[model samples]
Target: MELLELPLDEHLEAVEKAIGEWTEQQKRRCKSAQRTSSVEVAKSEEELRELQKQKLELLEAIKQAEVAREQQKRRIAANENETRDLQAEIMKAEPIITSLKSRENLHQGNLGNLNQESNKSAQAHAQVVDELMKGISLYQKLGLLIDKKRENNLAFIFTQLDPNNPNREFSFSLRIEDNPDVFLVENCVPEVSDVNELLDQLNKTGNISTFVRAMRLRFKNLV
Candidate 1:
């Protein structure tokens, strides 16, 4: 009986040892699986954080786009108001501008008429001057010389008194005045006492050539 009991005890011990080794192996496999699960969880958490950051940035961009769109709408409204005001002002000014243009056209027509009258007067004056110059040329050969000055307002008369002394001259100046229209004699080389009487006759008759001839005859008698 003792020998049979000893063999049974040895078999039991072997079974117990086998059971302990299997339990240790199962514990090691469980710990390894837990470690792998922790690594997967950490990777998933990091990915989730990155996705949340990207979502916040996208939301901020959308908000900024909305603000810019509102500002653009306000600017467009302001430009439209300014455009309408300018158009209204232009409409108000149209009649005044038309009246000013009409007045300008009327003034231009009056100026044209005045210019035509002025040209006709100048032509008539030129013809009169041409005839006077021709008469003066004829008188010059008869020992009478006339010099006009001060826009024809002053006249210088030179007369040869003595036929033998052709170089001897009796010279006098006559100035014309507009108020009452009188001829004033000035700077007579040989003073004549009857010059005022002769000037009165010339002014009354408005005959300058006849007075010059008579004055030359008087100077010749004195010589």
Candidate 2:
């Protein structure tokens, strides 16, 4: 009976040793799996943080874009307002601009007319000067002295009447008041007998120089 008990005790000790080794192996495996799970969880947390950072950056970009769009819309609206104002101003000033253009054209026309009238006046003045020069030359050549007392009155003196009477002068005055074709003679130096007949011839011929020459000849005959 002692020998059978000793063998049974040794078998029981062996069985207990086997069970403890298996439990130790299971504990080591569980610890390794927990370490791996912890590593995976850390990696997942880092990826989540990266995704959140990216989302924040995207949101900021969208916000900036929205602000830029708002600013652009405001600028566009302001430009439209300015354009409308400019159009209104142009509409208001259209009539004034047209009136100014018309006035400028009228002023140019008036200047043109004034230039033409000045040219005509210069031409008439030149003609009158030429006629006056001709009359002065004719009087000088005929040895006649004419003095204008008024617009229609004149005094005439014949200087070269007779060679013997060198100092003798035949003077007369002619006046025209009412009639342009008729002349009144007065202030005769020599009392001519055919003075009325000479005046009739002068009225018929309308030649004052011929009448003066005839009077001079008549005075020479008397001398």
Q: Which candidate is the best by lDDT?
A: 2
* Number of clashing residue pairs, candidate 2: 0
Work out the TM-score per prediction: 0.53, 0.44
lDDT computed for candidate 1: 0.75
- The digit string of per-residue lDDT tens for model 1 on 1-223 reads 9999998999899888888898888888888888988898998899899999999999999999999999999999999999999999999999999999999999999999978876765564454345556656776776666666654344545555577887788877766554445667788778888998999997787666677677777777778
Query: Clash totals for all models, in order?
Result: 0, 0
User: Candidate 2, residue 90: CA error in Å?
Assistant: 1.7
* lDDT per residue (tens digit) for residues 1-223 in model 2: 9999998999988888888888888888889888988999999999999999999999999999999999999999999999999999999999999999999999999999988876775565455434544555575555677777665567777776667766578777876534244667888888788988999897786666677667777766777
- TM-score of model number 2: 0.44
